[model samples]
Target: MNLFDYTRADTLGAAVGAEGALLAGGTNLLDLMKIGVATPSRLVDVTRLPLTRIEEHEGGGLRIGAMVRNADLARHPQVLARFPAVAEALLSGASAQLRNAASTGGNVMQSTRCPYFMDPLSPCNRREPGTGCSAIGGETRNHAILGWTTGCIATHPSDLCVALAAFDAVVEIAGPSGTREVPMATFHPLPDANGVAPALAAGEIITHIRLPDPGGMARHARYVKLRERTSFAFAIVSAAAGVEVAQGRIVNARLALGGVAARPWRCLDAEAALLGQPPTEDAFARAAEQALEAAAPSGDNAAKIVLARRIAVRALSLAAAGTPDRMPALPASVFEGDVHG
Candidate 1:
């Protein structure tokens, strides 16, 4: 806790304007600051702003305010019943206490959990604009494979965000320019032309997230994660799936993966494979295979290629069958798995 000026903002406009840095739950930002990962001169507290709400949209979508706690969102009966994948991903991450404090907006805006990016002494382009990224050559076992550039290899680490991508949720941003919505896939950008960092600009704040209400897919959805530990750890690979089934055939399907790319990795090719196909293990496996068609795993993370595929297939299979696996007990030990057919 370094000495920093703090302001409590009561409105979105006030909060976005009064910021040196915006603090919601202070879960990610404060942690980064404590370890010298983030050192801002000022802090604007947005948690007090009336942004915490979860309501049904008129067009069958769900509007989630930025300040809504992760625990609250995960436990919301409507969310659990309708968008179980979203709730599952939220509950599967962190601990109950941390979830109670973490907000949907903060979680969406959370930084990548790259070790080099977090270490001040480490050479990371994201942390230092001109400094070279050591992760590209150094310890990159857990780094990104898809959407990675020669300059950076960090992977995004939000399970909730990955699910949001699958749901095609849009982030509601409020800043000096009023409020606008950006699709969740576009909300978090890949390492820019500079090759070392994300693309979020200054003065912009994520005010809320809007998820399209599940139609038939609400009946079948799941989120699965594989981590070093059950609780309080980032994912090695995770999957979120929403399957809409009619009779024995699949109608609509979506899939997203975390800890596998620069942002929430959507498997468009995999998704295309499931359209109009029978809801079977073979179909799910093919979809998973198509999803990883262009994957480029790095260093010790080569195993992620297999694990990502398996998780994707399993998640889709469960969703298609309308039966998800029970959440494993924590602290969960990681297991070695394969993805090849």
Candidate 2:
């Protein structure tokens, strides 16, 4: 095993200034380290820092500290009432025990950088420059169908990020230079952008996640994922959708997809399509078409393109139906909503 120094950071500054992997809950980091996928020489433990508060933001939204556990955030009264999609995304991930131990920031950071991850023995062009993406010619039934390049056909696996991206969540990051905020949509690398091989910038640590006021969309939002199993599984295709309907017309809409791209696939065109339209299956189908307009199969995963489109429509239809009085016992289940789309 590779040797590494371990330090428990007592302050946010100490965690930022430390030059290595920032350990929050260590749910994904520890697993990656054990498999030799991550070999940081130093582990900066940031769990004890005073970054666990969940408070109301100035914009009438919630400012969630990075260290807040997934379970806590999902169950927070404000989160459940105002941002049910975010809560549903959290509840759909892993299991009760894993959610209890996983941090909000860690879940965003845990998104995969390569399609062929979890196998350290495989060579990765993203991990080591010019090595070439192994998944390019290998198993791609579960790989990307959008925003993939010859260098990588990676997929982001964060369910929280999909909901966060749809609602314009901002990531508050701290570093030697100081703290700054980035929208969750841009927090991770985009398919067409030059991105870090490793997800985070060097020496920077996420301190908080700032969610904007959901406004009308808060009452009508949903997160749905098509996973092989009912629980503890990654999405084959997932969608987070929110719409503001007034006088039987959509005034605003937000749509984002996961398990299809390097980052949560925000459907700006899809959002635009839904605007001024009645909240109906026909409108959602048009938006779904717009969402997948740029998508192309990287390899043999052409079916994901069809599945992605269907889920976008499903999520939008469910969002228009309004959030449930209580979260469904089975998130992302077809049986949970009135309209399956």
Best by lDDT: 2
Clash totals for all models, in order? 1, 0
Clashing pairs in 1: 230-332
Worst 10 residues of 1 by lDDT: 332-341
**Candidate 2: residue pairs that collide:** none
Q: Residue-wise lDDT of candidate 2 within 296-315, one digit each (tens)?
A: 98888999999999999999
Best candidate (score: TM-score) = 2
The residue ranges of model 1 lying beyond 4 angstroms of the native Cα positions read 196-199, 323-341
Displacement of residue 206 (Cα, Å) in model 1 is: 1.2
State every prediction's TM-score relative to the real structure. Answer: 0.92, 0.93
Q: What's model 2's lDDT at 101?
A: 90
